[model samples]
Every structure is written in structure tokens, then in C-alpha cells.
Target: MIVSDPATPHRREGFESAPDPRLYNDDLAPTEPIRRTWTTYNYLALWFSMSMEVTTYMLASSLIAGGMNWKQAVLTILLGNVIVLIPMLLNAHAGAKYGIPFPVFVRASFGPMGANIPAILRAIVACGWFGIQSWIGGQAIAQMVAVLAPSTTGSPVVTWVCFLGFWALNMFVIWRGVESIRFLQSFSAPFMLIMSGLLLFFMLHKAGGFGPMLSAPSHFATHSAFWHFFFPSLTAMVGYWATLSLNIPDFTRYAKNQESQLVGQAFGLPVAMVLYSFIGIACTSASTIVFGRPIWSPVELLGEFHQPFLAFLGLVALLIATLNVNIGANVVGPSNDISNLAPSVISFRTGGLITGFLGLAMMPWKLMASFGSYVFGWLVGYSGLLGPVAGIMVADYFLVRGTQLDTYSLYRRGGMYEYSKGINPAAMISLVVGVAAALVGRVMPLVSFLYDYAWFVGFFLSGALYFVMMLGHRVRRSAVVS
Candidate 1:
């Protein structure tokens, strides 16, 4: 009803402009959204939050313990980071241009009828993470309480109650919607930085020197074994990192420009990432030196500190930082994704609430078993799905579609995206075929030999399938147009 003039100065243009007007559908875009104040520092802080969590700590320790020699692990980390950078930045470009969430962009490739496949898959994975991360945050509080209230028995009831309490708290924050999420990022990021600084200082003091510990491994493994372990974790990290690449447009759409997005990536990925890695390494290494054993949990590591005041400050900061990363990387992406499934019916906040409650009801504790870290492992499987989706989406956008998305059709059911009576079988078929191939390479017990390369396998499979499908479509279109 109220359409802003297309030529108005407030209208964004160029590569970053909304080329497809469908994105302006009422009740979709945020009102009074923040301009592109998200500079290199904000992106850096984002990646900082992402890479500095319990997962990062566990992965680093696993890399070293799995016999990757610290040097090999470091190489794997660097290489994996570089590999994810390309796709992440590409997706960010979409966000900057249109200011729409990632799932909305999916309609261009998957069609309005079938975009839900990837969107739902992404949302399911996100919900699991929501519960898991909330549980972890709750444990951080439990650890802090244990130190203060040493006599209180840490029973199952207390643990679950605290976990549920924290879970609800996050749900409330998310219910407040994107503005609340962004505000949380702004408020906590600086405090996390200060805490990280203090963490590094204390870790170095405990280590006696950074240099000695960097080279402190007492045992070494064969180069082949080192490669085996290093590559898996490295590949896993890349898969994990790229999980957000397809969805980052959710956040980057708020970014000011492609320049800002890249700046954010630069700070967000390599610089922010390596800083977090260094701190994680330092913290874990210091624990080894000081307590005579390595501790994977930052919460547990903080427990060993003597000063009560320092422990309190460190625990609170770590808790906030971990929660920030989970909410940003894990929650918001899926919120946008699930909402895109039925734009008329579900708003982003409603979708988040839906997924949040579903996550809690799934009994996430079942996913955690001694048989293996199944929950995290299942996440890796879900991440494998992301690679092909990215490859297909990227190929369709950049190669076949020429980076021009039909934004309007993304909202209307019988609009231009009705490629063939409500569904694009090619997209659906390619997704299944690609995911099947990836599952074989990653999780099919028989092909365990090639498991380390699942992401690469998935990427090529999806890209090739999508390309072939597009070729067929183009040829058919030419026949009709002539």
C-alpha cells in the first residue's frame, strides 16, 4: 500500500541494492533496522564469539590429542579457515544487497514450493544446538555455583532444573526478536574482549612463557597418523564454519555494504578466529601446566583459579560470550530459515519460538551418549548438507541465474518461481542425490576410508547435479522461446 519511490535517495542501489522488489513484502523486513554500523570490528567480534566457545576448546584439544602434533593441527586450522572464507563472503554479499535473511534467498534456486527442504533441515539442526548450547551455558553457572557452594550435591534434578532455566532465558531473548539479539551482541562483545585479554594475561603468567608451551608436546606420532587426525578435525571445523556461510545473509543483510561485509569477514574469520584459537590453545595449555592435566571446558578451567573475585568475573564473562556465540551463529540463522517456509503464516520470532520449544521437547540429553558424541557428530552430518546447498545455491546464483534473484516471486506462491506447478524437481532431486553421496563419504560405515573428504565430495556432487539440471532447463526454454 505504501511504496517508497524507487528513485528516492534512501533506496539502496548498485550490487548491494535490492534488485528484486519482492523482498519488500509487508510484515517481512524489520522496521528501523540498524544501518551498516557493523564494521570490521563487529564482524571480528562475531567470529571471535563463534570460535571462542566450548566447541572450539574441545576441537583444539581433540586435534592435539588425536595425534595431529600441534604443528599439524595449526596448519589444518589455517587451511580450513581459508577454505570457508570464499563461500562465507559470497553469501554475505547476498545479505548486503537485499537485506533479507538467507532462506528468503533460497527461493531463487529451490523455488517457492520446495525451498522448505533446506530450510527445515537447517532449522532442525539449529534447534538441537539451541538446547545443547543452553545446557552448556547452564553448566557454566553450575560450575560457578559448585565452587561457591561446595557442599551442595550436584544432582540430576538440580542440573536439569538449571539447564531448563537457562534454556528458557535464551528463548525469551530470542522471542524479543532480532533487535534484542543484535543488542545483546553489541553489549556483550566488548566485555568478552576485555575478559579474553585478562584470560590471556593470566594464562601466560601461569604458563611462565608462551613460547615454551607452544613447543611442549612430549610425544609425537607418525606423519600419516598426524595427517589423519589433523585433517578430520580440520575438515570438521571447515564444515562447522561453512554451516553458517549459507545463512550468514541473515545477519549481513543488516551490514552497510559489500565492503563492510568483507571487512567483517576479514576481522570475523582469520583475525578474530586466530585470536580465539590462540587464546583457547593458551588456556588449555596453561591448564595442563598448572593443574597437571588438560581441561576442555572453559568453565572447568576457570574452576581451578584461586582468587574468588577473578573466578566470578571470568565465569560470568565466559558464560555471556558462549551464549552470545550460540545465539548468533546457531539461533538467528534458523529463525529466519524456518520462518521463510510459510512467510504468510510465520514471522521470524514465531519460528524461533517454535523451534525453541521443539528443541526442548526432543530430550536432547538422549543425543549425548558414551557410544560417541552423537549430538556433535550428527551436527557434522547436518553440516555436510550445508556444503552441497551452498554449492548449488552459489552455482545457480552466480552461474546459471547470473546473480539476479527474482525477489518478488520469493513471497508469492503462484508467482514467477512456480517453475513447474509449485515445485522444482531438479532442485529437490539434486539435493537428495548430493546429500546421499555426502552421507556415503562421511557416514556410511562401509566407506569409512573416504570419510575425511565428505565436504569436498558433497560440494562437487551438488554443483554438478545443479549445473546439469540448469542446462536441461535452459535447453528446454530455448526450444519454447524460439
Candidate 2:
């Protein structure tokens, strides 16, 4: 039954209403319209800052290293991003319309307590990413040190120091709050673009020309071989941003309106990813001609430069890019997810600090040890876990509830979302089934395609299952104030 509290003035706003202390906190509250100030430019800048990082470069360059040429790798990245953007936009809608973060927004589908299952799962992945990005940033710092003092090059002691120092910088930013991230992304996006352009120009010149740089032929001998590689690679590409595809509400909740977040992300995500990835492909291809072998690591490539001054500038750009992405993409989601565990006790700053410590424990250096491990093992692996969550969320919001959420009930203990003792059995069952289906290919060689197409399989399977399971479930309408 749809419940209405006509006597309450702020029924829909979810503010100025008494909420369960266990579920309500200032950080997790539905944002007021007045506080929704993020415009299209802000989101555009957000993606621009995020996509210019070393990992995006590695994501493309790894595909090149795997076998495909520049053209094929670029197209795969473009298609994957476009596919993921659909889920991103769909999920972002709730955040903008309801003005709630991912954790709170998820309660509508997962129920109040069960929401933590997916939130923690997502947080763990973000912690892994935080570690990976921090490791890259530390490498950049270590490279800068090498340029100054050659003896310190490859020193494990110096590397550890740089890594922890970089990690500390990320924590400092988190302490300052979310608005600081907005300011950081806005200021860094354009500068990072300029730096990327310079790097592209340098690579082209060094490799003789664009033709020589991109002249590499496909290593795949047969159509079958290429197709076999393509599916998983494409999945990895999609999986790359699959994390954001689920947690975008964390950012979009602050958007000024639907148009701003929608248009900003539409323009920013794919364009920035494809453009910057093209740079990675072109530069990595150029590396083969310039260095006589593929130099996929930009950090290592910069080290080959004769001038320390130029290398220093390149490292500095990398530092900014890594920091921008690590904080914006990695820190925000996990911090909020952790806060959801105990909203009254854990604040955003505390959650961010915990994320940093967990990032260290994840040992990112081993995760990025090889291109195969980074793309196939890590990227594809997490996608299998997160895809089902996305499917459940999108299905619950659009298919079942029709995007109408009782915003106030979200924070109340016995409200509309309190299904079956604060957990929705159907959502949980669908999630497990979806994850198992996507990952079963690992153990069963015959069904390996499921693993290769992990994200797509999990997304569709869970979404359909959830839709069917919710067929008889009654929809709850939001309260209307008289």
C-alpha cells in the first residue's frame, strides 16, 4: 500500500522529518534542491580528469600489447564505453531525481540492511582500485626521484616511502570533503589534456611519424583467435568503468538537474576515454618504433628520455592524473559505502581513512604485475561481481518502482523498504544467481564464454530475474503533502 503523510510539510523532501538514527546521517541524507549545484561542466571535468589517468592508458595499451592494432583497440574501447554509459545514465537518474547517494538509493531495492551486502562488495573493489592508482602515483614520484638522484632508482625503500607519501596525500584531500574534489577536477582536467597532447606529439616525433607509429599488424593469425580474444577484451573494457556505472549516483546526487548530469556524463565519459585511449594506443605503438620494443608503462617510457627536465614534467602530469582519478573514482564510493555500514558512527572522513588503509592491504603492485592479470584477471573478475548489483538496481528503480521513491521512508526503520526484516530475499537470490552464472565459466571450460562476457551476462540475467521475481510485488508510491 502507498502511504501518505499529508500532515508533514517536507514529506517528499525527506528533510525536517524525524528518521531512524541508525539509518540517517547528514552525509547520507537526500540532498536538498538548493544544495544540488553541480552543472554539466562539473561532470565533464570529472570524467576528463578521471579518464586521463595511467590506468586508462594501460587499459588501451594492454589491448595493443595483447594483439590488436591501434584501430581495433580504439574501437573496442569506444564500444565498451558506449555500452557501459547506458547503465551509468540509467543509474544516475535516481541520484538526480531523488538526491540520494548510492548507498541510500540502493536501500529501495536491497532493503535497508541488505543494502550493505552490495555496498561492501563495491567498497572492496574501490579499495583495490585505490591501491592500484596509489601504486601508479607512487611510481611517478619514484621516477621523479630517480631523475634527480640516479642512485635511488629501483630502491625498494624509496619506492615504499613514495607510495605511502602519495597515499597520505590522497587521505588529506579526502579530509577536506567532496567539494574539494570538484575544485580539483575542474582545475586539473584541462591541464591534463594539454599534457596528454604534448606527450602524443613527442611520441609521434620520436617514432618518425603517425604512420610508422601505428603501422603494427595484428598478431592474431585467425578470425577465431581474434574473436576469442575480442569478447573478453571487450568485457574488460566495459568492466573498466563498470564500477562507476553502479556508483555514479554518489556523484550525480549533487547535479543541478537531470540534463546537467546526463549531458555532462554523455559527453565526458566516452569522448575522454576514447580520445585518451587513442593517445595510449598511438604512443605505445610509437614506443615499439622508438625503443625497438613495446614500452607500455608511461613511467618507464618517460625514464628513457634524455632530458631530466622533460621527464620531470611528464611525471608531474602523471601525478596529477593519478591523484585526480584515485580520489574521485576510487575514494568517494568506498568512503560512502563504508559509512553506510554504520551511518551514525562512521562519517565520510573516517570511511575515507579506512579506505586508504585497506588499499594498502590489497597490495596493488601484484595486481598490476602483468597486462593479462590487470585486464583479464582483475577487470573482468570484478565486473562479474558488480554487474549483478547494477542489474538489480536498474531493474528495481525503473522496472518495479517506476522511479518513484518514498524519500523519507528510505531512512525510517519500519518504512516501505523494510521488506522481510530489512532484507529483500529476491534481490539477494538474484544477485547470487547472477554472479554464479557470470563466474561459473572459470571452473567449467565448456561455459567459458560466460566468464568472458561476465558483465553483460550478469547484468541481463540478474535484471531479468529480479523483474520476474518482483512481478507480483506491489509498488509503493511516495507521500504527498496536502
The candidate scoring highest on TM-score is 2
Per-residue lDDT of 1-482 in model 2, one digit per residue for the tens?
Answer: 34334223146545475777778788888777788999999999999999999999999999999999888999999999999999999999988987888999899899999999999999999999999999999999999999999999999999999999999999999999999899889989999999999999999999999989988999999999999999999999999998899899999989988999999999999999999999999999998988898988898889888889999999999999999899999989999999999999999999999999999999999999999999999999999999999999999999888777777678876877898999999999999999999999978999999999999999999999998998767432322221
Give the alpha carbon lDDT tens digit for every residue of 361-402 in model 1: 756666543112531365446656777888887877777765
Please identify model 1 stretches exceeding 4 Å from their true place: 1-37, 218-220, 362-376, 442-446, 474-482
Could you tell me the lDDT of residue 153 within candidate 1? 36
Displacement of the residue 59 alpha carbon in candidate 1, Å: 2.4
Pairs that collide in candidate 1 are: 22-408, 36-256
Indicate the worst ten consecutive residues by lDDT in candidate 2. Answer: 1-10
Q: Best candidate per lDDT, number?
A: 2
* Cα displacement (Å) at residue 442, model 2: 1.6
Task: Pick out the ten consecutive residues of candidate 1 with the lowest summed lDDT.
Answer: 1-10
- Tell me the whole-model lDDT of each prediction, alpha carbons only: 0.68, 0.91
